[model samples]
Target: MAARALKLKPPPARLWISEWPRGAINAARLAGARRRLREVPRGDGRPVLVLPGLFNSDRSNFALRGYLNRLGYRAFPWVLGRNLGARTIGVEGERLFARIAAVAAETGAPVTLIGVSLGGIMARLAAHRRPDLVREVITVSSPFAGDPRATNVWRAFEWLTGERIDDPRVAALREEIARPLPVPATAIWSASDGLVNGRACRIGGERAIEVVSSHVGVQLNPDVLVVIAKVLNGQNADHD
Candidate 1:
């Protein structure tokens, strides 16, 4: 990585505080855009698993799952409870892989994964370990690439997961997950994100869609929903 990239920093403190109000506004935007959101092309009934961000529960992704279901895709939440990092999934993410495999087995087809924030990182790991069971991956506001510290939540992540971000083991896992995924992947990021640096969310070699939104709002943003719908339908979001 270049020296400049290595020096990447988290979003400013002001932006961090703005996330709350911005998230509320984005939610309102989503509500107002519902009619148009429903206009996105439908899917082919492929199963999609939606994973929530750190400290968030499946209930947080309820809106997203409902939207996907309305579009003809079978979307389910990561039912193992609120995301507690390694505590929720296994240290090696064995439990997450098991969930993905179960979904694939139930659907009789490789499953598509849509993960938000830390959930996205876990999704990529699962895809890396078992691409055979994963059809594709879509990440929203997830800092899978670049320094994980380039996010305001790094401290919270460390506190909750009970692991140092600078630990060599964590660094190794980040490098592994940051690599290009074996399955098709798309990254949805926001330059206005308050929780994580947008640059870190999108890797150079993968498909990326940019939206203007707060980090907490990306998963619920109507624009994000549209891009995700396009990707799942196999339509080009190259214009983004």
Candidate 2:
């Protein structure tokens, strides 16, 4: 019989108190954007699709997409309005898949997918379903490898998605989602994440980079951006 997946305890409530300060730090990243922009390797104008987390929309990833655009990559948003977990994934996932396919077709090159939090999970599923359309994937603070309920936001996910965490359908889908992607994938996690359990954010046999930031701040954190640039440029030998 297959072994049961281990479930980690959610992060402490006290740690969540640090989330506000982390948001401020991420906001301040804009001040040094130009400096950091020059520090990272420029992209080859390859197509990149950015997906937002749960309860977020394309607008949430505007800053990150803007940064990618400035770095010479053709970054595009998911275009599908706000993410509503299973509601989005169940009904609109085909649309998301079609979007990636369209971008890959237009560019005549496999698209790189960058997903934040729940968005990352969607990215992985997209890659798994259509690896031919994907070049590489980078997940920001996403707990795709472990139990979905391992994060503090699990309750919210259930409430918003209207799917119970332990429901048979959710359980079966979660099992599938936890599988490794067929393409080159990187998981960028934080040690100080306030919403998700960092320990649950790992996939076996893939590159995992640790950054110091909050769950929400990973998108704007300078170090995280640097790591992303390196991964995209194929400059990070460790990930290769």
Query: What's model 2's overall lDDT?
Result: 0.82
What is the clash count of model 1? 0
Cα deviation of 124 in candidate 2 (Å)?
A: 0.7
lDDT of 2 at 166: 90
Q: Give the Å shift of residue 75 in candidate 1.
A: 0.2
TM-score of each candidate structure, all chains considered together: 0.95, 0.93
Superposed Cα deviation of residue 7, candidate 1 (Å):
3.7
Candidate 1 per-residue lDDT over residues 156-205, each given as its tens digit: 99998897888888877888888888899999988889899999887777
Q: What's the alpha carbon RMSD for model 1?
A: 2.1
**Cand. 1 Cα-lDDT:** 0.88
| Top candidate by lDDT | 1
lDDT of 1 at 199: 90
Where is model 1 more than 4 Å wrong at Cα? 1-6, 238-240
Clashes of each: 0, 0
